[model samples]
Target chain A: MKSLIGWGVKPVDSHVNEKNDKAWTFKQKLFLGLTPGQYLGQALRNPFNWILGIIFAVGLPLIAYRYFFGLGAVTHASNDYPWGLFLGFGLFVMVPLSASGFMLGTTVEIFGRHDFEPIERLALLNGLLGYFFAVVYLLIDLGQPWRLPYPMFVSFGPAAVLFLVAWHVATYLSVQVAEVSVSFFEWIGWLGGKRFIRRIAIGLTVSGIILSTLHQGALGALFNYAPGKVHPLWYSPFQWIHFFCSSIPAGLCMVIVVSTIVKKTMAWRCDSNFSDNLDRCTLGLAKGASLALITYLVIKLIGIAHDNEWGYLATGWGAWFLLEMAVGVVLPIILFAYAIRHQVVKVARLGAMITVLGIALNRLNTALIAFNWQLYQEIPHIFEVIIAVTIFAIYIVVYRFILYRLPILYSWKAQPEEALAAEAVRPAPIRTTPSPAGAMYRKID
Target chain B: MSGISRRRFLAASVAGCAATTLAGPRKALASGTFSGYPDGMGVLVDLTRCVGCRSCEAACNKEQKLPAPDRPFDDMSVFDETFHDGKQKRRPDENAYTVVNRYNPEGGAPVYRKVQCNHCNEPACLSSCFVNAYTKTEEGAVVYNSKVCVGCRTCMVACPFHVPAYSYSSSLDPVIKKCIFCYDTRLKNGLPPACVDICPQEALTFGKRKDLIKIGHQRIETHPGRYVARLYGEKELGGTSWMYLAPVAFDQVGFDPTPGNEPIINNVKDFLGTVPMVLAIWPAMFTGFHLLAKKQKGHDDHEHDAEQQQGEDGGEQ
Candidate 1:
């Protein structure tokens, strides 16, 4: 067999191979390593970067304009539709999709499903970045972002559902950071740090599960505050359950979608184990997602029935709701189930895409479209859309940077394993590379 | 089955049946009840008596220390004001704390309804605020503090009455602007709010919530055919600190008739009750499945090891 890297392939001295690359150091990795020149090079290489550049050029000044002028400048500033895409998409949708961290953590660590070990770190990383960016989106939306910690150490709203969400999301972000830090520990050659995390891995996974379940559900419950405001088809007293249940599939399918994207775009970064088992794992994950989607579809109907909202099914909003259900929920479920059973990997990938769109649509419906059902619709400002896109671009850039360096995609080269073994077994320390996969494999167990 | 075990099963079944029967009716009973504190204060504003004098709007603006409006307080031309969409009425904004909207019902002169915070007995804004920015005082006023507010605007989403307006222009120190029911100026001192006190036609009545309900009923009874059969806010959404007596139906003036008698918080309680259950149950259930799977994997590994050893022995022989 021909070597995968052909003889004609140039040994490019990319940033990945640079000596004293800042990303290799503990301090630099913490900052997301790149020399200022290399960072700018990567930014200029991608066409998406040009789009982001255009967006920030227009949006950053507009954001500053908003602060200098007012929200009225960038937004419609209607009393009827107070919350636009910022809260709608940024907070509601982003939070639930980011639930991937806890769901995958619970499966791999708490449930001891070592077969899922390959993508576990990716899921954790996806979650941490998603949440960190969600907060960033929030800072832009908040009238007073500086006071974000007020709900915690400051005045506490113990009785509010939002209060619960605020506390849990803050705590859960910390939990996810701890969960993903194992990879960072290995990259920095902190063996002691890695071992300590391994010992408490189960506890962290369990806590992640608990926190994810509550806050994801809590986001939906936030809508329950506006019983009359949200359309009947979308509103249910059991909305929390609907949000929580749908998030399972959303989170699961998000991993499949992200991994698929990574496989296509950054194949060099992925290790052999991850690339080899990906097809089987994708099928397995799609099966789980399909089951969750079916449950979600049934419960969604049950919620409508429980609220006795059959009359709403005849309306225009009802048609839109049905379309969302048919396309986002039912279609994806059918495709995923069919694709998984038939071993059609491409079809399963398509289904995962549909599921991602479905989650976004459901969130958009709840937050923006269905909200203020009686009021005129408020389209987000052009600048607002640009800013949202720009932020997402930044998210992808950060995601790519981490994947290129972290042991998350590629297993770390163990440092002088023979020396450690000989030091324990004999007086002489013979140096050799340790089994790179052993730490992660054992920690996953 | 053993006799002891059979008897225990029978006893458990009987106890379960009895417990279900006892609990079933109690759950239904809890869902139907609605009552506010007997002494909670309330306001009753009669639309028929309101002259559209703009006195209440002026009083509210002055008392709240809100910024000056573009038009003078005495400008009746403001009543004929239209929005950019040509909607013939302007609502209260960040600058104006309160505005009276004129709705011309069929066969009736324009009926003016003052729009401000209803200060519900169970304020949705108070419950929805993540930082506890709002306070629903026992005096039947819903007040807020700007200091600790993250300005998430969740309260704006939660308010059923669509009352809270954000100071979006004030980038440095934006806060929610809404009616506080004069908690600091009057309600705490046992006086009526500025709007109520300054009503020249006595259109606004201030009293205990229970007494306000009675007074509203008395006016309807005396006139018999003058007012609608319903007293707006007497029972809507668990009742509001401010009530209304209009000759026309409440919905004709944009009041949501179907808010139900129960407070908005009651709708949220069902979900809140499940939070603790999910937190407690999911960890153990997932961990149990993990252990079972691990045990199965161990068994499979052990059997495979034994089979390999047998193959090795045959090769040696």
Candidate 2:
């Protein structure tokens, strides 16, 4: 792919071909301005695609097997442990990690921090895809995955915490689709939809904040029903706050982790605006994450103190809990502090990676490990693990597919007429900016 | 920014209103101390009188028309069948709605405990279900509507007694399987459940839940040292329909010792109460933040770039 780019291949970041000033057709756009052979060549050349192939070879069948033979075929399906890895990992773990959308939206839009604007669209796309795949994992895990709309249409259990989860996730998915579709509008040259979304951007952002808060906290509240089941060490009276607060860091750190990966792997796809601003944005996010991490750490201790389960700290489970905090919470806090102070983006990136893992660990502990602590631990079935990995692989594939084509990493350059319209409008679009980069792309005009 | 915030605030307020209307009435009905119904029936199982005969298990199997057991109802070897590496005893599942597990606490004789849904006054399954699949009936039988069940198995996660098992083996339509206290067949007609009816040793007593409370206390008061003084479900998780009297400690017979008196729903009410609060406060509050931010942006321009300021004002939010 890098060799192809060396041979003067241009990935589609706008509608026009710089060569003859001819409009790139939808086919050309889909292929990143490559011929079908070249598209296939680039895909096959990448070893990552081969790994995805190997996973899908085994995983797709297992997913079908689960559906055909029922969840019992691939899962332990034990009465003692109802929610296996599918939910423990898929729903509980994925949702918090995907919270980058609301966090960045609130920052760049509400707080008017346009310096973070370069990565805002990426954050939104991350949130959208993460949530979409979380639901995909859910559909695979559910007994009647097809009846997902039962809560909304057929029946209503509005009082249940899960009811809020279903409604908010569904509503928030639509909200995210609208939020991220601005990029698609630019990619497809649909100025009207872009303008319409721009008109209601504030409304959309405000709603995003509301839905994100309730659903993120509601996910934690679901565990409150099983007070006797989840271990006292992980369980808390203020489980919602613990979940909500921790997600602030979880979401921010996830953005850090994702942006770092994007920067390293796909630097060509990024504009100077993105690459130059990323480190600063990352450090800024790290600062926010450290603050949230401290709050989460303190509240976690407060939960323990309120419960008077400080005695559990000496026990093995307590050690495990402390390990989570030390690695996931406290270590990151210290690292972020030092990195921000020293302006070392690398250390902050490492902290972000660990924080991502820490959030995963914390959620996995609350939902799986520390759950049923009285009973013996139940390892997930091999097939269940395979299916989960498969879905996540698909998630990555879809994420890359968008990042390669859409203007998430690079600001899309509007045509002259569109630019005139953009100038007439105020503040321009979120990521789109007037720059020398756009001047370099104009062919004859 | 003000126009956008005002419109969004109105939209958010409507959403808040919708949340309230949707969650309010149902919660009001469920709120406060909801003890069982006035004429609710209950069962009192006296462990001191039980002989681990397995007759009640047989009666339950026959009554519910469950699949044929691997061992017949007469098999005593099933008592020793522990599962999940002996950490768990035989439990109610898709095949059987009730099971009797034999627990031999250290230095005590083997005590048999009938394991089934405790049918709490405020059932966790009832509260945890997003489909409203469970119901604590007027007769105190915590029944289920499998037709409405989406098979999320949240009920299984929420059931503290581990009674509501999923029919995971069925690919087409799996649902929660649990003892409904024979609500459909016998209890609706004012007849006792088959297990309670077929208790040859009279270990299971069936009557009004209120009367049964008195009877349970009387037995504990009258027969000194014969039974554990505490009634296992008189106030456990907001009073189960099936109360227990054990010869040994309740925990010795596989009961949770610290199943608090407050209903399981109480634990979640704190979070649930905040849903409306968050929905109401966040839009206006965050919009105010946005206005403040835009104000700062405007001051930076200082009337030099009026067009840019207007753009910032609209696009900032």
Candidate 3:
């Protein structure tokens, strides 16, 4: 891989490649010029990989068992609780966190906030992988995974909320793939692909925003089907609004959370532009999150009042609801506000973590814990938990693999002119000298 | 900068505003009402006359060709079954289309509520179904097409009565199992449902929904103290094909008394109303925000240019 980046090689323009030249075949792109040993070394060095290996070892068998024996093999399989952690964590929680792609695409491409350009690819990739993995989770949880597309083509359940979810998520996944493909173009030295996407970027971003708004809200609309099953505090007819509103903060904070983890765990993969601008980006994200959180908090209160569910607040479930609001929404709001004002990036990071937890809690409350409120609570079967974790680990591995290889955290080295232009745009600091080492560092950045 | 440009902008804005106002609320209003087909059929089950004999259960089992139960049809021991930490008494499932639950209320003879699909006049399962697998027949029973079912179980979620059950144990194909009011065997042919026909005690009444309501009222009026005043399904959850008359309170017999008079679909209308609005409005709104942000960026560029020029002058000084 290092030798492949040698100075004599001219970068391929994706637009030109698409028209005149053959693009890198899928096999060539997948290998990425790495020797098998380097790949294995990197894979084995991470402790996270060992954990993932253990999970896959345990969970793959259970997943097979579930298919062969039945859903009763790995799940509690109560007719009362048809959906469990699989749908709750996988579909509900994952989809909102994955909203990062459209949000960032709209910011940079449509809104032209180029300051956000550094993390834009990362967010798009996050969204694509999150959605892709969410579908994967659905496949595992579905009784008939093979018939997944039946709702789209075989049968038409146009009136059903799940029908909307199926169509939108499928469409949105394709949009996200197109959005994220620009990074793949750069990584494989294809500039024509990049330029063509850039030309249609505004249209794609706008469409992305529209699709994401409906589907994110649609996921919430799903819970409205079970008004009696979900606890009152979580169930609102305006659930779609609550879901859409909360997702704004959830998506922004997820970027903060993921970026924070990336910075800590894989700093070498990030360029200085990304590493240095991260704190400023964290503050910017915190400001956005605080505004969203306050709106969410107010509307949540309104939902309670609108339904006259204030009396339910005195009960244990209400206390649990309050706890979720306090820890997840309210506490994070205050923390983000204070953190942004004081320029406390660490506190903002902590607030982002809390907000992520809050989003998970809210989804779980709706989908599982408070589901069938009149019935006994169900803990996920051990095998079921392992399968969920294993799938998530696969998501993380794919996320890291893309981040490591793609131009997400670093500018693509396209033409020498664009490289020089990027250098000129950067605030000149201590490294203007033309020593051989300095030139190499400059090229690397 | 010119009057003509301003006039053109104003004209465009007016057109856009006109288009939005015309399209927005009209679409919302269209999705709100879900009045069932006027001539759709419905059934009325009178529970007060039920004697807990399990005759209807046997009849339904035979009519549906379901697998035999572990115990004999005459076994009373099945009624004592409890599940989910004793929070639930056994109701209907995939094999058992209808089950009689014994709810012992205070100061009342234990009520035997024969539970099955109420087959709503405006069925939530019908509206919530994306593939349109469910249909409300003019004969009044809600029937489903198993061929089209993907078994996503949205019908299970949409059913306010918790009537739809999936055969999760099946590996290859699973369909939502519920009482179709014996649509294929009897209801469609102008025959009373098998369970209704076989009931020795005349506990189960099968008639036009309107006529059944009148008969229930007449029965209540004839014997005031023998039954509760209100018909259980007359207006609950926007009315059901199977009506109930109980000597004890409805809640005592495992019925949810407070599922509002509005149909289950009504609860979802507010969200569905927003879908088209979002599809129409979000594009322009986000695009407008983009244009505003772009304009701000342009202003920032001009300020940076001014600052750059000032810095050069200071360097020369």
After superposing candidate 1, which stretches have Cα over 4 Å from the reference?
Answer: A1-44, A418-445, B1-37, B80-89, B299-317
> What TM-score would chain B receive for each of the candidates shown?
0.81, 0.91, 0.83
Q: Write the per-residue lDDT of candidate 3 for residues B1-317, one digit (tens) a residue.
A: 12332343334333323322333354354364544455545555666677788988899999999999888779988778888768889867888999887777897677788899998877888878767789888788899998877666777777888898888778777678899989998877888888888888788887777778888899899999988898988888878878888887788888887888888777777766776677667666866775676567766434323433443343345
TM-score for candidate 1, residues paired by index: 0.87
Best by lDDT: 2
- Distance from true position, residue A50, model 1, in Å? 3.4
Residue pairs in collision within model 1: none
Q: How accurate is candidate 3 locally (lDDT)?
A: 0.75
Task: Give the CA lDDT, 0 to 100, for residue A330 in model 1.
Answer: 91
Model 2: residue B188 alpha-carbon error in angstroms: 0.7
Q: Candidate 2: which pairs clash?
A: A426-B311
Range of the 10 consecutive residues with the lowest summed lDDT in candidate 3 chain B:
B1-10
User: Where is the poorest 10-residue window by lDDT in model 2 chain A?
Assistant: A436-445
Task: For residues A1-445, write the lDDT of model 2, one tens digit per residue.
Answer: 7889899888877667878887789999999889999999989998989999999999999888888889888997588889989899999889999999999999977787767787889899989988998899899878888789999889888779898888889888988998999899878877657766655677788888888888889889988989888999889988888888888888889999999989888887998878888888899999999999999999998899999999999999989999998999999999999999999999999999999999999999988899899987889999989999999999999999999998888877665555546544543433343356522221100
Residue B41, model 3: Cα distance from true site in angstroms: 4.2
Task: Give the proportion of true interface contacts each model preserves, from 0 to 1.
Answer: 0.58, 0.67, 0.48
Error of 1 at B285 (Å): 2.7
